[model samples]
Target: MGSGPSLLHREDIHVVIAGGGYAGIQLAKSLKNKARFTLIDPKEMLYHNVGAVRSCTEPGFAKRILMPYAPAFGQNFKQGSVTAINAAEKTVLLSSGEMVKYSHLVLATGSTGTFPGKLPDEMITVAEVTQKSEAVLKLVQEAKKIVIIGGGAVGTEVAGEIATDYKDKEVTLIHPRDKLVNGESSDAFQERLKEVLQGLGVKLVLGERVTNLDELPTDRVETATVMTDKGTEISADLVIPCTGLKVNSTAYKDSLASSVEDNGSLKVNNLFEVQGTERIYAIGDCTNIPETKMAYRAGMHAELLAKNILAQETGGTVKEYKPDPFIMVVSVGRKAGMGQKGSSLLPEFVVRMVKSRDMGTGRYWKEMGQKPPR
Candidate 1:
């Protein structure tokens, strides 16, 4: 009834998507019918980390968040990480000793948080973090005191979720700056976030420099006591460090004509393509795109790149990727959040109604071709 079967029989278009995260999966889906796609990722499943913060409170959400690639893309899925990329050869070398050739390559390797890269390779996915979530939750469940080191959205959300859900827990958010949600949000937005956190019984430890983690116990269920530069110790049973993300581009560092920024993100061109490379493109947290590394933006970038690549192949005008100005919707736990659309700070109710309720899980489910559960 459709040209899909007939088109599948022909092998004209070949696309290789590295890193089956937000950007890679969406881009692969966009070109699934039009091209022969090979999705490569170290993990067998595609993790939706948009709801990662909420997963700390709702553990069951973890299963729904991680969507497997094999079911979504069929034979196109390849279970392995890309060890290297050869722009000249237009091929990607896998960790499994297999080399896959590509007509076009998309790097959507995403990123990891400020965790030291000392952990074994096996525990890397959202599942690993989710598995640790319960242990972390157990600490929170028993802890009378909690200290969140970092005042970003993730840190704020973590503090809020804990304070709101587990009211018994004493949560204290420590930031090195004078105000919370620095750089990403406006002053008004930061004030609102601080107000919300304070209202929900979270101790706003602002203008404090954490010199060291002195009283963090050696046991698994231990408190995180941080010592300030002024020799003041703020102790808590649980400490969730929400620093920044580190882009995963080490594999392609030597192979491609790529330049890393001061923050370690790869610099890409207007077309989302890595500079000086025709067949290669970088997206998501890995690229130094002038945007917040959100899942929605990554999906948008991937879709744009896939369309442009297909257009280039078929002799159509290529579309350029101009990132929309920074728009952040941060949830201060259930039914409360702060959003900044460009420079405009939307009301807290607007943010809550749009994003805070479900952590954008419904949007992700629909995008991934799954019917969101009622």
Candidate 2:
């Protein structure tokens, strides 16, 4: 009864979701019986991107990192790269040379990266995740020295995961800033993170920049040696860049009616509706939501968008989105993490219990109506 022949026979109030990320699928499942939904993305599997850092280092965990979408969504899920979106007409064009029409559209194509933040560019299947995860593990296994650029959440967490798994390897973390995790966190939290990472044998090279990536001498595609701004030369068998998120915003450029942000996200009103548009809404990393881009925030946005859309259908008063206090967490390794929940520094045990134990992937699978990997 979730989605199949019975649902297809019903009349269409088509809701086409342009991405299979957390926001897109959450809205689709929440609005299950309320509308005819079509969720589209290029990858055959919906990614638990947060777990990729640890999964890359501990390749055995790859089995728990990916889930195919077809099982959860049935026939309503479409696997194809969205080439374009016609926001005015509420239609999406896929790479399969097919056009999907909709009465409502929600764009939630979350940010991606060139590194472990997302899967490799050519990888689109669950099997590819496993294969590439093993390849990444091979890189970790083969390298005696590892260099991580940026001291943000992903970079720091990756460093910890690698150090935890391979204690013999020399791991160096370089950042231009004086402290790690500078955004939306306190100095106490930053100091604690520094202490934890340093205790794990991660060399913290702070307050300096690795400014010349192109000039680095490469031993291989995975290995390089570079000079820092302070004239220190560091050589590593593997270099990983977790610089930041790059919003995937080019697809809807023509359709967004000149309201796209310079950073490749759409500008939206407080209700999470795209500015100057009525039927079209935007959420998650693809929107200028003014909050730190986190999975929980995206889930809240999806719920709010669904509620407002449902209200618009039934002629009821639409509810505005009011977010809970910001909670920030970083999974240092499989059993360790650091976090702050609303101005209180969470204890290490609390961080491990909440996120680092399994990276919140089980809860995500539960919401998606799938069994977690054993």
Q: Which runs of model 2 end up more than 4 angstroms from their true locations?
A: 1-12, 215-223
lDDT of each: 0.74, 0.80
Which residue pairs in candidate 1 have backbone atoms (N, alpha carbon, C) closer than 3 angstroms, thus clashing?
223-237
* lDDT by residue for model 1 (1-374), tens: 12322234447567888888889888888878777889888876766566667666765655666666776788999888788887778888998889998878888888876321112247556568557656656666777777778877678788888888988888888887876665867888887778888999999877777776544542355646678876778876666667655677756777763466666667788898777777778888899877777777988898788778766766677888888987888888986898888889988888887788887777767766776443
**Candidate 1: worst-modelled 10 consecutive residues by lDDT:** 1-10
User: How accurate locally is residue 135 in candidate 1, as Cα lDDT from 0 to 100?
Assistant: 60
After superposition, the stretches of candidate 1 with alpha carbons farther than 4 Å from their true spots are: 1-12, 114-121, 124-130, 214-219, 371-374
Clashes of 1: 1
CA shift of 194, model 2, Å: 0.5
